[model samples]
Target chain A: MQNLALETVAPVVESVPVPKITAKDVNVHYGEKHAIKDVSVDIPAKGVMSFIGPSGCGKSTFLRCINRMNDTIPICRVTGDLRIDGRDIYEPGLDPVLLRARVGMVFQKPNPFPKSIYENVAYGPRLHGLASNKVEMDELVEWALRRAGLFEEVKDRLKDSGTSLSGGQQQRLCIARAISVRPEVILMDEPCSALDPIATAKIEELIDELRANFTIVIVTHSMQQAARVSQRTAFFHLGKVIEEGVTDQIFMNPRHELTRNYITGRFG
Target chain B: MSVLYFSLLLVMAVLAFALARGRASSGARAAAFHSRPNYHGLLAASLVAIPMLVVFVIGAILTKMIAESQALTALDPALLTDPLRRGAALREIVEVANGRFRGNPSITLQAAGDTWAYVQRVARFSIYGLGLAAGIGGLMFALRSITPDLKARNRFEWLVTVLLMICAGIAVLTTIGIVFSVVFETVRFFQKVPPMDFLTGTQWSPQTAIRADQGGSSGAFGVVPLLTGTLLISGIAMLVAGPIGLFAAIYMAEYATPRFRSTAKPVLEILAGIPTVVLGFFAALTVAPLIRGAGEYFGLSVASESALAAGLVMGMMIIPFVSSLSDDVITAVPQSLRDGSLALGGTKSETIRRVILPAALPGIVSAFMLAISRAVGETMIVVMAAGLAANLTFNPLDAVTTFTVQIKTILVGDQEFDTAKTLAAFALGFVLFFFTLTLNVIALAIIRKYREQYD
Candidate 1:
């Protein structure tokens, strides 16, 4: 693993952008289990970054750390530096509620609120006071839905429950909800795992379009998906980042033994 | 003693016949049958026991009645003047004839004893004849119908199912019967006293004749005072219970840890187990005096048995009724909704207040309605804490008598059945039933609407 990091292939030959998020020797412990070891990583702005790992490898934990979603769990403890856009989210006087609004997340299971489709999309905007009036809120909801490519299918039934939509449409409705708040960044945890292949393709296309406006970070188990949607990919193993590089190179070229094995379907 | 054992033996014989028949007719391919052989045994046992038991009970009752009547007829007619005296004399004659009496040295008594003996013999003969005829008739009919292909077990089970349905139907029918009885008696009461006077008249004193020549005073049948008293007490009770119970429920469901929840819930429920009579005394002796002192401090006259005292204690009794049910309904609201609200950056209190409470509103309303019904039906607390005076005013501090209290007062001591005093209790009960039923129906409708919202 040390030799692979040193080799570093072309390194993109471009000026590396300033890190929007930096984790300095971050470690998380859930009771007796050391979920994430001393891991350091930096994520840059305005592009899709993918975290690829086997199950229970701390990929989801690391994503939750960005938004302080782990605060909801009583036993989970994170020690060391984790900053978003150079701001310490865990600093004294920092409110997780405020931080969550600034750093939005979409869950793996596509849990849309048991509310009307319009309400589902407008919920974040309403909570964050993103829109001042009903008309503005309506426009914001439509914009978010349009961005998620769900407007055409759900436009006629904005008043219907979000759950009444198909599995794929529900997932998109969740995405629309996340985007409605106009957060600086969106964290998606296996956003397409519960969707069919067609929906998966649609979400991948939406992710590519989303990268033009907002910084997007997604956790996915599908290597091909990571290659298709992400500009950069990080491979995790045993709660440690084994390799991080351009997605194309990571999939096709030589890398760490574990990363190579995982990419080639030799082993998880 | 032998008869019961003999019946058991007959049942066993029938079971053996059915089991053997089933086994023999099932042929070499035993597994081909739809049901097991024991089912046939049970069916045959039921067929034998049911008819025999019915005959035994009927014959026993009939023979007992006939024997008693014959003994009464043989008794000296001068000793049995009325139905009450006749019953007592007949009982004594039966005891004497059975050799349970210790009297001796009288020829006429001995002759009467012989006549009693003859009556017993005739009754016994009648019982034996009826029992034997019914038993034989049933046995023959059942045996003739028995066949190898007969699915007696299925038919018998179906009959049992219908019997259970009838039993349940009887419970509903019994409730209806009781309601109608109250309604009919109340109608009779209203016929004597005009409905308008009963409903709108203020005074409730029912006068009775003090002497044979003195006519009873004109009794006031107004129910307004009782209705007002009931409303005042119920209002105070709801005031005490509604907010406290609902808040406690919210805390238990949303905020309490598992350890605190497990301990607190049962302790709260223990309030419901305390007998209402005990609470009544506590209210009467302790709370009423304390309230009077408090009222004195405020320079107000609070009656010793005030509506406020009774209502507060009754409210305490019904707290568990509201809290436990509300807790269950609030907890039943999906955790996903909470998570969704929190994920959207809503504060915990905000999420609970806006989302969870609204979703659980109907259930909470139903819980409150149930509590109200319980309050209306409660008798003991009001009887002890609230006074016998049916004051028509709505003031909680004033002495008041509820419908239940009035009913208890009217029926407490011996009174003539024909008087309006005794019958008014039924009328009051009917009004109470109507009020509680309306509350329950409205609450149920609200709950149904909310259920449909979620479903």
Candidate 2:
């Protein structure tokens, strides 16, 4: 692999109370192809951090590493010092299953399990044994659905199939499912990418509300989405993080030329 | 004479193709032709071949009728009073005409023979003339019709479509024909033996007494024992195949690496391709004795040829059916469902059991139904390993018989066609057909209901 001689900026973060997740020199490879390379960043507690990039720039790859979702791919390899709350997630003693319980994900496409709406929301809690009785499980499902702002619309048809919901509703259902287990961190991989503008606005609003209780990391292709929803924004280009800073400064006065060109839609 | 006509038709077809292609591609209107010159040529050749073949076939059939009628007319009226005697006389006349008769013939028979030979020659000559005329007419018509605006390609394609339709029709019509034939025999069997007795009686001895005074040979046509025996064996087979096949499918779909799956799937399917007769021999010779020995060692008296042995082998034969169908449906389950469960902190087995299996339940149920039908219809293994006794016992250690085994035993001998014993096979077959058809219909219903769940 030839190393480009472009200017490399350090990961810059403005003052925050504390960082909930941290990464140092993270790299990912799918077989021989280098994907994410030497990227480092800090995600603050209880705030939305968005990674924006072009389609093949490894924003999604790096997002999946938070929950070890990429471990399902047999050929993918990850190397880095990744920690959640000062604990290494990739330590030999850590079980991916347990780590996933504390880190929930919402996919780009609305992927609700082929099950009833109630069951979809309750699935995680059931798996983790969070509820001791039927009443507790039902209450947990309703609370999760209400937190994701999808309870009123789907409350009448709780027994309906999860797939029976509309595109936007299904994504919200997935969000509800993710939060049913009450994870500390939530990762959204372009969750609003598959929805219309109306649904997208609703989800954006919900993400802002969700930031009060959970540390959220989101990957988006839309620069406006990052500007609107995120407090911190990281711009990735060619498997490297070009710049990271407060969202306002990153969009208004980007230090790196690549980040400026990408944010301004000069080229992506 | 037939060979001469066929060769003449082939030559004419070739000539028609060449002439039609030359005219269609001529410089005068070559650029304006609707179809390529090759299509025009193909259309002309087909026109020549089809009409000529039709004429030749019809003409040959008419010639045989004309020659036989003429030969019969030349015989004396008084000699043709009896139908049997007339048939024999006609045979002798045909034999003499062909110079195969070895004995001396009477005067009238010799004259009839001469007339038969003469009439055959005249009819055959006229048929050849008619066939040639039809071929020439078709060729002339095809040559005149070829022009720049003619849709020769469309016409030829229509002909090809008709040919394919005819081929498909033959397959469907043949299946209907077999069903009707079986139905008719079943009706005859019902006429001789009451349907109630055949369907509801417990006894199944199908031997009819040769004389009225013969003792202990009364035919009893009850089919209950066969039905019970069939259910017992098929039940056992399902018990064995259902779990093994489902587990194999899950292992291949979820756990096994692609390299292992590729090699293991075909090796498992090879069990299906092994001849049931070969499997039967293994069941009778090896598994049966081993089972018996095991039973005796445990202070039990297992039959030398037991239902357990046959059911085990039949189960082996049916495993591929279950696994292959199951593997397909399990693999067809979308990846998103699996991912959703796994991301929720569900263990791999929990995800498979709670989420993936429920999503694929409809398809898996249908696969099991199809496998059960296959086990029900299997015969050779049961025939060899389960003894010829109609023991309606549910115990796997006892010898038993099934519907297919009884059907095979009834049909595999020289016997009078109309006897109740022989016709019973057709009845059993009809019942078996109904059983499998019902199962398949139910399977299709399940697949139709849930096919669109994931998409």
Candidate 3:
């Protein structure tokens, strides 16, 4: 009787349009444990897509796959097709370093280097040779910080330690650092989990404002956070995505029992 | 003998009774309870033991001395007129009284012998009296004071804690006492010899006039030569050890893999465990000859007992001191900093050179300072490899004598203690202590300041 009801309701939910990043039969394994099963999904370009799941369900793993950050872990192994803008990143001769420059990341915990705020934002640009002179580098730093909404608060203390900022400010500093390189895609792994509620709201507003410029993929534990910040939501359980669609329809009317139970607070 | 033994038994019996009474009272609950059963036992034991041990030890020593003195006083007047003869007569009398000597005695021997017998009787009686008093007093005290509420455990713990503190303070006091003794004797030596002569005179011959008619050599006591020799040898040691030890520490902490580090660190530390005497012989026989041969090839004249040989060997002996400490401090730097640098696309070597080395600079400085101090105080290597002549020269190929070498030479064999030559050792010791103490204090202050900046 429940199967009949789910079948009748599934067609009423409209699927969101797929993005330029498409993963076909992607699998990730850490030694004997399969972290991500065979999964296929497409992330839309110039839009915010949030990966929401219970803890240890590989939401962060799927997000890391976009930037190839899992290559840093010695024991992790990834197989199958992964492409960005129809170019296969896993192909031979694709340097992870250059790929990471184009697809930047922000960690869950704010990890600003123990250096001046100017140095922290200028590090990526200096490495990639993005600016021609000192004046150009200064302009780029100010532009990135202003876009991240941290220029007004920290404009006077450009030479102060990056760690001297508060938790919310440090996270925003990390975001400014990512944007300084002008990456095509920004992957955030629970960027606002460590911040207070007010800081979280500000970060969510920044995400909505960022959707017009670049693709943003966020992994969060809060389903409401996904609803507030993302245009599309992908729900994962036990290393598999049960359902994904427009954010409002997934919340008000989910096809899978697990997704409905999770949204309605019946069980997670 | 039976009365003394019975009194001891009575004391033990009273202690057992008190413990049993305390336990029985505790079982009644409410207002009857006062203290734990174990507290009662300890209280009774302390009361019985302290007084008895004190009285027994004191009485035994006093009684023996008094009895022997009285017997000596009763010798005949003629025998006593000659002090040596009277002393011999007293000894013989004691032997005879103790049943070790037997002979027909003259008037002096008879009188001495009669007094000795009386002394023996008095001694026996005194021992019995002391033991009886101690045992009875202990039992009465225990019976009066074994209350249930007494905090015996707390008092016992307090006593133990005080004793531990006293033991720790004794070590510190002993160091201060030694320093004061050396300073006092050195001051006395300086008073007899003019301070200007001791400090400025280049020739160090410390003889004096043996008699009024005979003029002895007026000795020179200048310390410039000794100071020069010490500084030259220590400088050579620092030259040899500093770079090698620091490089080895860097390699072990930053470059070596886990398997290599585990194997190499222990092998390096084993160099420190070898006895200094063995190193002295190796330096004297092997290193000295080798250095001489090398110097001959380069058209330099090197003595068999040159400062180079001793400094090289001493440097080898102190390598573990620098390497182990430097390695520990380098490894103590946080891994987060390393990861942060690597994540910024910096190479591993660049990160270690620019970030890690600067962070560990203060600790490295301290390690080198400690090694330098160890090099300065070293004795066996210099004594064996360097000659005894105090040469005021900086040439490494020449022979030099250090302060420790002079101290050993002056104090060895049969020598007159009152002469300025012997007393100079005390002065040398005082100077060495101050030099090392100042270096250690400066190193500690620098390290503490650096630590504050980071932590």
Give the winner by lDDT: 2
Give lDDT tens digits, candidate 3, residues B1-455: 44664477556656645754565355446244355565555555555655665566676677557765666676656666787786677679877676677666666556666676886677667666665566557656655665555565576467568768989999999999999999997998797777777667666555556765766566668878888888888888888888888889989998898789999999999998888889999999999999999999999999989999999998899889889998998898776555444444444565577557766878988998999898888888899999898778899999998878888888889887677878888877777788889889999999886665444
Q: DockQ winner among the candidates?
A: 2
Best by TM-score: 2
Q: On a 0 to 100 scale, what is the lDDT of residue A159 in model 2?
A: 91
How do the candidates rank by lDDT, highest first? 2, 1, 3
Name the runs in model 3 displaced over 4 angstroms: A1-268, B1-164, B193-219
Q: Per-residue error at B171 for model 1, in Å? A: 3.5
Q: For candidate 2, write residues B59-100 as lDDT tens digits.
A: 778877777778778788876788978889889999999989
| lDDT, candidates in the order shown | 0.81, 0.90, 0.79
lDDT of 1 by residue, B1-455 (tens): 33754665485557545754565356665555454666655665566566666666776677667666666666678776788787776666666777886667255445555677786677666655665565556555555665656676787698689779989999999999999999999999988888888888998887755566876566788888888888889889999999999999999998998899999999999999999999999999999999999999999999899999999999999999999999998899877677666766778887788678977888899999999999988899999999898788887889998888888888898887778878888888889999999999999889886665454
Q: Give the 10-residue window scoring lowest on summed lDDT in candidate 1 chain A.
A: A6-15
lDDT of 3 by residue, A28-131 (tens): 99988999876677788999888887788888998878777777566899998999988998898897677777887888888776567888898778877889
True contacts kept of 3: 0.08
Interface RMSDs of the predictions, in order, are: 2.1, 1.3, 3.4
lDDT of 2: 0.90
